[model samples]
Target: MHYIYLHGFASSPRSTKARDLSDRFAALDISLSIPDLNQNDFSHLTLSRQIQQVEALFPPAPAPVTLIGSSFGGLTAAWLGERHLQVDRLVLLAPAFGFLAHWLPRLGDQVEQWQTDGYLPVYHYSEAKELPLHYAFVADAAQYQEESIARSLPTLVLHGRHDDVIPLQASLDFARTRPWIKLVELDSDHALTDVSTEIWQAIQSFCAL
Candidate 1:
């Protein structure tokens, strides 16, 4: 089985969770791809192109591909699975399905400032401080409505109980519509800091099936 690890928005392949997951999979001699999605020219790449890059990294045999995506990457994984990629299973961690709904409002003032200043301020959990602006522009992008994607593939969703970013209800709404989806609630925040073992166990069980 092949696995792909996708990091969240404004996050790199070097994230704590990514590194931990990589180490766990590596110990099992399983190959996984955790690419650096933090391109300075992210605005220039279309969503389709981003998906293409991910697909190109995998074999073409239509084998079962397990996708583990966090935040914006989860949204991208759902979109890819629905439209083009042949994913056997998916694990979405605090996915940002309502990106436009939530972020557009918060970023309303910063949008113009980013356009004018050519960058916007962002926070990095590792740095524990404010950082310079990084930009990602989605053009005529289709939303990843969880219900729509869940209809096609078996998915496992893990969300924090106290998640401040993407609400737990979004995943709950998805589970309501798609009976194949399983939800595992945690006590951590949006980053899912302390539940790595739980997440890995869930993945192992799903892969066994």
Candidate 2:
């Protein structure tokens, strides 16, 4: 089975969770793909392009592909699964569900500036900065219809109970609407730094199934 690991917005394959998964999968002789999606202009890049890149890394339709997406990546995975792209399973970590509602307004003038300047400024909420501007464009382009999408695919959703970024209740609502969805709540925050073991366990269980 092939596993695709997608990082969160403004994050890369070199992120802590991505590197950890890569190392663990390598030791088990399991193949995984984690691509860098932040190496371009945020306003110009679309979610379709990222999906195409992921498709190129894997095989064509009818082949089994498991997607593990974090934050914005999780939202993208949910969208892909809804499109019926032959996904075997989906694992979402602290997915940004109503991102367009949250980010687009906050980005305000930056969005218009992106249309004019051809790139959006990377907004830094905390100490960590320096991510690609195209990430915002991708986020802007994402549309969440989890209720319709989760019906067709087996989904494992991991969200922190204290997730300040994306509310945990939103994930619960999503799980409540879908029959094939499972929810695992942890005590950590949005980053899920302390729940790696549980996350790995969930992945192993889903992959085995």
Candidate 3:
């Protein structure tokens, strides 16, 4: 089985959660591939582009793949699983369902300005500086629907009950009708950084790693 990890938006392969999981997987003598989703160009990031990039990293079929993603990356993984049968399982950490809806509204009137300017200055946690991301990012993300991700598989979603970024209701709604998905509500916030051990334990039990 091949294990691949995708980091959250504006985050990198070296994120706190990514490194924590990587170290845990290493202790088990397992190799985890965490790709840098930014690809050195945060200026032109799009959800479709992210899906394509991660798709290229997947090993050939029959190898059995497990995807572990955080936040926006988690949303990307869900779409990937829907499109590729090669994805055997998914571990979503606060997956950004209803991402555009939650984020766009926060921009308020600036949304129009971003469209006119063609870019928005968003703070990238990994880079430690605000980056000018093209408006295409929002446009591309709007094309994907959380409801359309209907692929049935062994999926585990760990969401924070107090999540303000992507409200817990988003995951609750997504998993409500999907019997294949197991939703575990954690006592943490959006980052879930404080409860890394709980997250890892759930992953081990669910994935049997």
How does candidate 3 score on lDDT?
0.94
Backbone clashes under 3 angstroms, per model? 1, 3, 0
Per-residue lDDT tens digits for candidate 3, residues 1-209, read 99999999999998999999999999999999998999999999999999999999988776789999999999999999999999999999999999989999999999999999999999999989999999999999988877777889999999999999999999999999999999999999999999998999999999898
What are the per-residue Cα lDDT tens digits for candidate 2 across 15-91? 88898989889989898889876544443556666666676777776788899999888887888777656788899
Residues 25-85 of candidate 1 have per-residue lDDT tens digits of 8888888889766554443434555577777766686676788899888877877677654
**Best prediction by lDDT:** 3
Given candidate 3, what's the lDDT at residue 113? 100
Better of 1 and 3 by lDDT: 3
TM for candidate 2 is 0.84
**Against the hidden reference, what TM-scores do the models get?**
0.83, 0.84, 0.99
- RMSD to truth, every model: 3.0, 3.2, 0.6
> Of the candidates shown, which would achieve the greatest TM-score relative to the real structure?
3
